[model samples]
Target chain A: MIVRPRLEDHLVIGKYTGKVIVGVGLLMVIPLLVSLGFGEWDTAVDFVISISACLIFGFGTQLFCRTEKDMNWSHGLVVASGAWVWATALGALPHYLSGHASSYLDTLFDVMSGYTTTGLYLLQDIDHIANGLNMWRHLLTYAGGQGIVVIALTFLFKGTSGAYKVYVGEGKDEKLLPNVVHTARAIWLVSLTWLVVGTAALTATGIWLGQMPIRAFFHAMWVFMGAWSTGGFAPQSYNTFWFHSLTYETICIVIMIAGSFNFALHWAMWTGNLKEIRRNVETISMFVTLSVTTLAATFWLAKANVYPDAMSLLRKVFYQIVSGHTTTGFSTVYAKAFVTQWGPIGLVVTTIAMAIGASACSTGGGIKGIRMGIMSKAFLQDIRRMVSPESALVSQKYHHIRDVWLDDGLVRGAMTITVAYVTIYAVATIVGVLYGFPLDQAAFEAVSAASNTGLSCGVTAPTIPALMKVTYIASMWLGRLEFMSVFALGGYLWSVVRGR
Target chain B: MMTRTRTLTVLVVSGAMLAALAAPAFALATYPPNKPDSTELINHQNVLGDVTKGLFWNGKAITFHGEAIGEVMVRGDYAWIHLNDDAYMVENIEEGAKLGGYNSGMAVWVPSALTKQIDTYGDYQHEGSIVSIAGVFNGACKQHGGDMDIHATSLRVLAAGHVVVDPVRPWKVVLAVVLASIAGLLFWFERKYRYLLRQSGRVGT
Candidate 1:
């Protein structure tokens, strides 16, 4: 029997959701200060309005839904999914207020795209946008890269079992420490350390490339946020190509790959388990897949004589493949170059790299390396079972942090999510084709959105159909959260609608 | 009087013939950019597309026009300037320009002497100088680590960029103040409830 959610359930969910909104509101302060610092009075006013709106919504919910009850698993999942929806709607205020977006829906699309770490944007004239608004854009991706729930847990929420549930609900299940709050802090520690080092390196590179000192610092910081978060929101429309520096590109590649590693892996490396990088299954899977895709793209482009020299071929192909595989969405070449320059084969290669994405429990969104690792082991196990005698027992094990035996449930979980991803990719592709996009371009864009890899092959634009925008938005949300929590949210809503 | 009249007619007719003959040459020199017919001029899309189909434009003379944006990075004798040809190149978002997709532009490597003609570069405040470049397009420049760029032989400023004044909407400020006041009251109310809950041991510190 489908029992409707009781009053207490709603209260707990609402209270936690309110807290996340408050955290989001607090986030607006950083951009507000930035706007003021730049003397952008109009943009600062946008942040002021947005901040006030968030506070009102947050406090209103908290005051109305005062609950002593703790959150259950369902409440946690609902809070996670519901919070993102609310965040997307409200966080879009600065974007809409900027008068750059075509409509509120377009602003929502950009906000969702940022939160999901998918680099597709509909905000027009990014080149001419105010510095303060630009700060908010990059900051959205950075905060969203570290699960928003993690932020609430780090600062707002107490160290309770409910915190862990909410943490898992945010699509990050790995616990770097025994306490969930401590785990969240550890993630921040890793990110902040990278932020310092990556920014300095990029700033130096930017300055060397002839950018002004202040401009270099800002660009460096924004690019670092985008790179380390594996979020592809560059300040300019040209993206990484704006610099036209090999040194800068190299630095981005390093940060992007490092960012895509599992948080637990970072914890291990920090704790002097350097050998774990070699032994980890996710790392191994990433290496093999990245190599295959890179080689395929390089060889194909070389054959087509796309680039003039070997140096040109390697720089463009390797940078793009790494960007795609990391799900970073940062690109050196123009978006259409994938279609017009590299052709169908290049598109297929990049799509494959994007589909098989970065490590599990990382900021990146895709099928994930760990799942691929497990599935490959399962395949091997099945092959061994076929060769063995009727009485023989076949089993397989893969090393993540440690060696763990692959069981039916584990395989089923991986397969289910993989199937879900493939299904969404197909649906998105069909919608795009129906809108008159070519099959290959549609497939490429659909996969890009579904994988939360923001690489565009000249498909994503402000002029795309509104329905396609909605479709991509849903794909990004679904892709970011994986499927289970969102599915739970759907089931919860359905029960509310038709429950006895 | 007859002789003077005849001389005047001959000069007028000759001048008219000469002017007519020079018009086509002048028009060819100032051809419109981005309207390539597989012959003379090419845009960003064409440059990229032609290269992909094994049509290399390396060291080929091409004419391009766009609004000069960002800073001019002067590296010794040569300077790098990015020029955008997007819809907003003429007008901007603050000026009520309609959305026309993402910015599409190319990097031009021009002499430091030529870059002095640009008065403004596009950004939030200004609409940048619109310039035309007659250059040799390089598919991959060996000097700049495989960067696709144009080496400009000559440059001309077609239009001057100007400051765009963006006024703050009064209604937004009024709404912000009202919302902030309400939020403050809610915060106080929520804090009061939290204190009560804490006192009753229903919530933790």
Candidate 2:
């Protein structure tokens, strides 16, 4: 049956879309107040201007586009993309006013990085920034990781149609619970609980390791949210290197893993069904990937004399491997130091982990592990068919929780998209190289930026060529939306403007 | 056997020397002594003697010929001037050659009373040109970190000239343009096949 698209669907989605934007504007007020509380007058002023601007636009959209309708696919795409752009523009206010960033463009880069949970920063001296403002930066990561739309949909919207559109538009394909609202709430609750417990544990470790009490507490809180959300903005200027203890690294490891787990699994555990833990395809794949990568990296680091002993080797390997695979972007070992010592192979493996990214339905960014699992299953089936006798007929089926037959169309589609992603990734790297970055460093930075991983080989700086900065920005944008939404938004714009 | 041992020792020593020479280059480069550390550096009130090692205010580089008290102010360029006795503004005397201290190009505001002694002893202009200042050796004054200005009792300006303002270099412009072009290209591609891209997911089913 052909389902004709309706204007009412678009209008309904547009109304909620406006509300979501307005909600984001309201959220901006919290950070604005925080900046003011710290006596960062300039930052406070900038936030005021930004909040006012956002409120004007957001509320104006709602007021003008009031309708009693539901959202369509096109409406969902527009709302999602428009919200991100608006958030990025408004979020740059604090960075711009803080005076750490050199230019408005640089501030946008940093803000995009934070909101996208990429963890790349243009701010030079984070240590000196006011406490309240610093907290706001990490808060953006936390909010962005779960998605502002998801939060708004769960808390504000009651209608099933609106919630479903927003849910899918926010890139959450799987519903852990029967009700979309319940699933969203459960995800947030589980994440929040982990955040609190993780913060307390890390804070204790920080104090024990001799960090100043207040600073330690704040650092722990920010790092915990960032890691558990896989957001990656560290409170200190040194990033994760400030807490140079194995205990600190281990805590982060757990947080990253927790952040990268599919929320459906968390909800299942919440319902006292522990068997869901064993059955998750994404989780199992992630675990296997983590183990293999960590061991390999550890061996490589030891061989290169980057780590002196087995314990030190494990610490570096495990921390970095987890950071990359989870797309958390926190680093115990400085990338600049590691790149110089470990050479090409080290960079390549880490890049692969970042590109593979974390489990779907989690906060982490990238192509996601579930998609990779599907691709891998299809690849194996193809191999099986090739090995079978010419005259023999075979039907291949794969089992996860249930048996599913593999088809050529499924395999072809996945491969096509994967290739498209790779092409985008390669172009970004090539741009970096064209701008005079060494080949390895260029590739590493490109992958990190595109995956929204924020792991750096010391190439990302304010001084980096403007062309390269723009490339990184595109990568971050595409990565956060998983590329598809961005494309849809582009098409929508073209259709409107060009009558195509 | 003795010659062989001597050669091995020489080879080892040379290898160690080569490694040592290469190590600093491989490590992340620190800013030169005068360049400000973005994190720890701040501008605060300090005595002239204390300001010798740290960042210099504006154009004024101070050397302690003798103890002086006055308010110090950093001007537009790398010139720092202190006013001596009398807690008021005055014209500053040009001192010697080098501008001493960190050159992060940030201005510090301080009281004129600090430069009273120098105002009385040296050439002082009362047109609010020179002020007394005292501050610690904070490396750089960024917006995030609080201001860095040294307290002074004397007024003196080493020299004055057209302080060169550095523009955003050409390389940065080139880099930015290149990046923007790539973004434009991506935007174009995304617009082109958006339907195919979006429907590809459902197409498998």
Candidate 3:
């Protein structure tokens, strides 16, 4: 029997969603201070207006939807998904007010992309945008990478038990500690520690590469944010290519690989479980997939004579493959070069890498390495069972934070999510093809969006069919939330319309 | 003899006119000139579009023009400067220019001495110097770890850049003030609502 949500259910969802909105408003203060620091009065006004709007909506919702009821599972799922929609809508104010995006929809797309850590953008004249706006863009990725729900859990939510449900709804199921709030803080500690070290290294490299000290510092901070989040939002249009330095690319590579690691793995390493790095299934899976993709891409490029020599081949092929595998969209080449230079084989190899993506419970998005590891072991166990006696027992074991034997439910769950990812990727690709893009290019872009890898092959632009833009937006949202939460949100809305 | 002379002279003149008429068509059929016409110069999108359609401009000398954006980063005898040819090059967003599209630009590697002619670079505060350069475009420069760049042989500043004064709009200021006041009132109400909930030991749906 279908049961409609009660008034308290609505209140609980609204109250929690308001708290998230408040957090979004608080986040604007960083950029607001930045604009004031640079004496960008016009830009400062944009933030002020945006901040004010956020506060009004957030506070008004809280005041009106006051309730003592704690969030249940459905409320948590709805809040997690619903908060993203609100955040994206409100968060776009700064981008729109800057007069950069072509329209309000474009701004929403950019904000959603930023929050999902998908780096595709449609902001016009990014080079001419204010420093504060640039700060906000990169900051969006950094905060988004930590998961907005995680941020809310860390500070706003006083109730502990229900908080974990919301945290799980954000697609981060692994807890580094027993308490969800502690887990959120631990994620922050890992990110902040990397921020300092990574920013300093990149700053030095930028200065050595002849950028002015101030410019180097700001670029370093922005790039560090982009790389650490695997969000790939470089301050300039040229992306990492603007620097044109090997050292900068190397630093980005290191940060990107590290950032793609699971938070639990980081905790293990931080707490003296050094051997965990070697025996971890996710790491092993990542290494194998990266090696295969890199080899395939390198071979393809070598045959095409894309680069003149070995070093160029290594730099171009290896870097791009790693960027794709980590699901970071930072590119050293122009967008069209993939179509012009890399050819179809190179494109397919990269698409595969992006589809496999990085570790589970990390900033990255895709099928996830942990799932791949389990599925591979499952396949191996199945093959062994086929050859053995019919009554004999066959089990597959994988090491994550600890050794675990894969069960039928675990494999089924992994397969379901993987199927969901593949389905979305195909749907998005078909939409792109309907818009008259080449099949290979469409597939590449669709997978890129669906996997939250922001690499583009000249298809993503302001002038693309608005329908295609919406499709990519939906893909990014679904892929980031891993489908389940969004499904729950859909069911809740349907029930509201037709429940008995 | 006089008639023959007249006929030959007329024929010679006719032949000369016909030759002149055919020359332009012949020239059009021949290979295009190395120097690009100012009106027909390729923009970023054109170059990118061509590449996306499977055309390579590697090792090809081309002409590109745009506003010199950001700062010139010097490395040895050559410096790297990004040139933006987007709509905001002449007027900016703050100056009430309609949004065109995303910034489309190319990276140029010019001699350090040539960059001196560029006085200003575009940012939030100023419009950058507009410069045109003739260069060899690399699809992937082997020297710079396969980066897409242009190695320029010549540069000319077409327009001098000046500071753009972007005074805050009065309407925005007024709107901001109004919104901030409303937000403050709402915050107070929110706190009061929470307080009432606590005091009553139950909350309204």
Candidate 4:
């Protein structure tokens, strides 16, 4: 039996969601101040309008729908989902106003891409953009990578359990402290510490590469934000090619690998538990997958003789495979080169890596490592059952923060989300084929989009069909949220349309 | 008398016609630059092969006005420089505010001697040198991993670029002032709430 949610339930959600939105508005002040400092008055005005709109809409919603009712799990999920939708819509104002994006839809696509940490962009004239707008671009990825809701938990929301609910609903399960807010702070603390170190190192390298100190610092900070978030946005149209330094590439590679590590792993490392780095289930899984994918891509490229030498092959082909695997989407090769240079085998290896993705509770999206671990366990268990005695009993255990014994419920959850991800990837591929894109390119791009990996095989441009654009957008949203909140939103909408 | 007058008129007319034909030739002799003796003239689109393959211009010396984009990537004796001759351009930094659409560019490897004249590189803040290059374009170069590139035989900066000055809009000041005031109001309200809470002993001061 289904109990239709009353209108009052929505009011409760609106109140909390409005709180998150207000937090987002306040967060805009950093960029606003940056633009003002840089005297990028055009970008400043756009931020002013956007910031004002967020505050007004947020306060108004809270004023009208203010509720004393305690937030349930459903209410928390609704608020989290609502916050993302609102964030994407209102967050798009800066991109749209900047005149870089073609339209409101394009801005929305880019905003969602940033917030989801999917590095795909519909932004044009990136090289000529103001410092302030560029700051906002990288900032969105950084903030979104940790999560806006998590920020709200630290300062805005007062309730403890309700805050935890919202956190869980945002597709995060790891908690470093008994208090969720403390955990949020710990995550930020780790990230900020890395940020300072990474930025300083990168800035030095940038200066060495002949950039002015100020420009070097700016590039360092933005690139750090992109890398730390695994967001993959570069300040120039050529992306990483602008710097053209091997040192810069190496630093970014380190950052990308580190960024894809789970916050739990970071917490363990912060303590005396150094073994956590090796023994973690996600680490082992990453090792296996990375080796397979990297080797497969290298051997294929070597056979094809696509690149001239070992250096070129590693720089162009290996880096891309690593980028796809980490879901970092930092491409040294041109977008079209996926089709032209890498060829079929290279694309397949990249597609597999993209689908496998990075560690769970990290700044990456796809079928996470923990789930893959569980799935592998389940496969082994089934095979053991088939071969052994009828009464044979085998138990599986995986080390995360602790030993997590595999259960039916865990398997079900893992399998369900994995199936959902695969289904969406397949659907997007079919739609791409229907639109006349070649088969392998479609599959590669589909997996890229659905997995929130920003690597493109040249299909995700402004010129693509409108339906395809929306399809990719939906795939990113669903994949990022891991399908639960979106399903809830869909169910709620359906109930409203049909129910008494 | 009529025969002599007719002969004088014909001589005068022929002299004027000869002078008129020789005028452009004299101007060409005094002109500052030697015309680059190249048959093919190309743009960024021709080098990048956007709508169609740029195979015809491949391995051919051509001349075009190209704006050096990004940094002059200094690699040993030679430099890898990117240049654009696209329709998308700003006459000045202020004019760049109204720019719409994407930036298109092509990479050219030129001797450092030629690139020394490039004082400014095109980016958000500064415009690069718009130089005309007589170079050979490789559609698929064995060097640089099949990248489409140009090897320049000669390069000349036709126009110089300056730092773009982005002016502050008046409305921005107004909004900033307004938002600051609102922020101030909120701060006061928060202080008042804390004062009341202190009076009520709900929290430690």
On TM-score, the leading prediction is 1
Which portions of model 4 show Cα errors greater than 4 Å?
A: B1-65, B73-80, B85-101, B134-153, B163-205
Interface RMSD of each: 2.9, 18.9, 3.7, 5.7
> How many backbone clashes does every candidate have?
0, 72, 0, 0
Fnat, 2 decimals, each candidate: 0.51, 0.00, 0.66, 0.20
Specify the poorest-scoring 10-residue window by lDDT in model 4 chain A: A59-68
Instruction: Chain B TM-score per candidate, please.
Output: 0.72, 0.28, 0.67, 0.65
After the best TM-score superposition of candidate 2, give how far the Cα of residue A40 lies from its true spot, in angstroms: 4.0
Candidate 1: list runs displaced more than 4 Å.
B1-33, B36-58, B140-142, B199-205
Off by over 4 Å in 2: A1-14, A36-42, A389-405, A408-410, B1-205
TM-score of each: 0.92, 0.69, 0.91, 0.85
Q: What are the lDDT figures for the candidates, one per model?
A: 0.87, 0.62, 0.87, 0.77
Residue by residue across A303-412, what tens digits does model 3's lDDT show? 77777689988998888898899998899977777876787888899999999998888999889999999899999999999999999998889999899989999999
* Model 3 lDDT at residue A211: 88
lDDT of 4 by residue, A1-500 (tens): 45677878888888778878888888888888988887777788878877876776676666567456767887777787878999889888888777677678888888888888888888877776778888888888898888888888877877556788788778788999888888888889999999999999999998777677888898899898888787778787667756656688889888888888899999999987999989998988888998899989988877766555777667766578778888888877667666655667788899999999988888888898888888898889888878888887877788998998889999999999999999999999999999999889999988888888888877887777888888888998888888888887777767767766
Whole-model lDDT, model 2: 0.62
Q: For candidate 4, what is the lDDT?
A: 0.77
Residue B78 local lDDT, model 2: 26
